[model samples]
Target: MQLFAIGINYRTAPVALRERVVFPLEQIKSALQALNATWGSNGLSNPHAGLPAETAILSTCHRTEIYGAALTGNASSMQASMDAGYAQCAARWLSACRQIPFSELTPHLYTLPHSSAVRHVFRVASGLDSMVLGETQILGQLKAAARAALDAGALGAYLNRLFQHSFSAAKAVRGQTQIGAHSVSIASAAVRLAQRIFERLSSQRVLLIGAGSMIEVCAAHFAAQRPHALVIANRTIERSLKLAERTNGRAIALASLPARLHEFDIVVSCTASVLPIIGLGAVERALRARKRRPVLMVDLAMPRDIEAEVAQLQDVFLYTLDDLGAVVQKAHTQRQTAAIQAEAIIETRVERFMRWLDARRGAPAICKLHEEAHRLRSAALARAQQRLACGEDPKAVLEAFSYRLTHTLLHAPTRALTQAQDEERARLVQLFGISA
Candidate 1:
């Protein structure tokens, strides 16, 4: 059986594409079972009847991926079957639940096979392949995906080993390297940049535009400064209330945002909405209401919660994720020392893992060697028993058995030495450090 990973992530696909393919957390197990059923069985035969291959699906805001090991099909055919199955399954699920077309979404898909897939998974778990480098959230996300796969009965030996290695590698990197040492998260960096505009975060009244994980992280960072007031606004009141309760802040419905916009010194927005949530007109009105008070705004959403034109407004400092790139870049040099240490650890682990893999690969040969040895031992014992049965002297029979066993053990090497060419014999003599 061969191991493979297939999927797309924030690096390879845009949000428009990602959202279309993203699987809800609730459906992941079923999705994995469906995929395994489709690929493991030949079409003419029972489509879902074969021993289902080991499979797992990992879907998050940043990426959606599948990892599996199967016995019958080659990589190409398996990948094609997976893609086709996913398209059909995704189409049905999306139409029934999300009202999206899977066909239109297929163009943006990416499929990684074999070692590339393995490398991609390791890099992802290690945070080398994230949209935000060294982001810790992806690690937890990966763990959750692995758990889901296990629950679906899709995790078999190969995938189980692969993921265990990946988890260990991620931990090693985080513990040994300074890659995640700096406060480079979009939220934290946004706050830092906002500090440049305003002298004190404590004096700033911050308005958070969403209640998602990113928004909560930003709110937590901002809360440490003891901001004057923090307000969370979300499309869902329950989500906003949950986030607001954590920080002793207040929650507002999304409908109330336009009216309440002008009361804040900073705005950090990240929403899952497909369209811009905070438009130029809203910011313009907010600016007017604040009597031209400078507002530092950060948009962390992929589809962009804030409007692009908002940047053009006077006395309004608008920053998108791209704007925070400079701050994130500044930490790269600072993290180099940590990265070097981490790479050394990764190298050692990689070598150990490769040795393990090589040992597994040699298992069949080792088994054959054991079987041959057992056969020779049994044959020698049977001959000794026959001599005893024939009333031969016990001492004679025992001596002959020992001699025969010694000859049997040494015969192959002796024959090879005798049959060797002159040059080969000379090399063998040299290898044994024997002077001719």
Candidate 2:
């Protein structure tokens, strides 16, 4: 079996495509089970019958990817199988759960296999591949995905080791480099942008959509502003209430969003919904109801919670995650020193990981060498036992056995070297570093 990772991220695909593939936290275990069942039945199971090939998925606002191990004839076949499986599974799941089409989605996908996948995952964990460079949130997301895979029994030695090593590499990078030291995350940047729009954030009423970490973070930032009122609306009422309680805010059911939309001056949404929750009509209605009061809406959702057309509305300021790029750019220079240090650390860790991979690749050869030696020793001991059983002297039997076993082991190498040509003999001697 070989290890592979295949999928696209913020750099390779746009938000439209990334959001279509993002899996909700609650659905991860089932999705991993489905993926394992799909691939295992297709001849991707482990050769040793120890465990099924490992599978884990990391799906966040910025990226959607699968990391797995599969048995295949070659690298190309492995890549093809992975791409096909991801496209097929993602389409089916999204269509059934989110009402998205498979055909409409497949074209936007990107697949990276084997070494490239490893490199990409490492880069992502190290914060080099994030939409907001040096942002540390991806590491936690990766860890969460790994835990989901583990819970679903889709993780084994190969993947467990790979992810652990990847995490260590990320830690080393953070420890050695300034990569994350001065980085301002998207949540913080959103707050910064909101400040530009309103004179006092404390006077603004804020509505946060979705109860996930990103939204929770934005809520915390907004709460510090002491907004006139803080509200959380989530598809799941329990989760929404939990977040609302934490922030000293009120909770509203997602279904009531239309009725509650016009009451807020600032809205920040990051949800797992595959479709737009805040459409042009909703925003238009909200604006009309508010008598054209300005509303700053930041959509952190992939695929986007707020429709693109909402940005065209006169009194609406709709900003997606992409729009906050410039606001966070100033910190890039501040983080350069950290980034350089982190890269060097990652480089060292990468070499160590590659060495470990190489050693694992040579394990069979090492095992075979020990097996051959044990066989030779067992055979020699068996012959000596037979001689002793035949009433031979123990010392003589032992001497003969030792002589025969020593000769047997050295005879082949001696004969091969004796028969070697001048150049071949010299090469062999040099290879073994023999003085004579």
Best by TM-score: 2
Please give, for residues 151-180, the per-residue lDDT of candidate 1 as tens digits.
Answer: 888887777888899899999898767778
Off by over 4 Å in 2: 37-52, 72-108, 235-248, 253-255, 411-436
Which digits, one per residue and each the tens of the lDDT, describe model 2 over residues 1-436?
A: 4576656666666666667677887788998887667655544354432223678889888777778765555556655665555445544554555455766655655666666666667888988888777888889989999899999898887788878888988887877776877678898898888899999988999999999889989988888889899999999999989999989999999999998899999999988776789888888888899999999999988768888888888888888776786677777887777777776776666677667766776788899977887889899999999999999999999999999889877776678779999998888788767775
Pairs clashing within candidate 2: 177-342, 178-338, 179-338, 179-339
Native-to-model Cα distance after best TM-score fit, residue 399 in candidate 1, in Å: 3.4
Off by over 4 Å in 1: 41-53, 70-116, 193-205, 209-213, 233-246, 251-327, 386-392, 404-436
Best by lDDT: 2
- Global Cα lDDT for candidate 1: 0.75
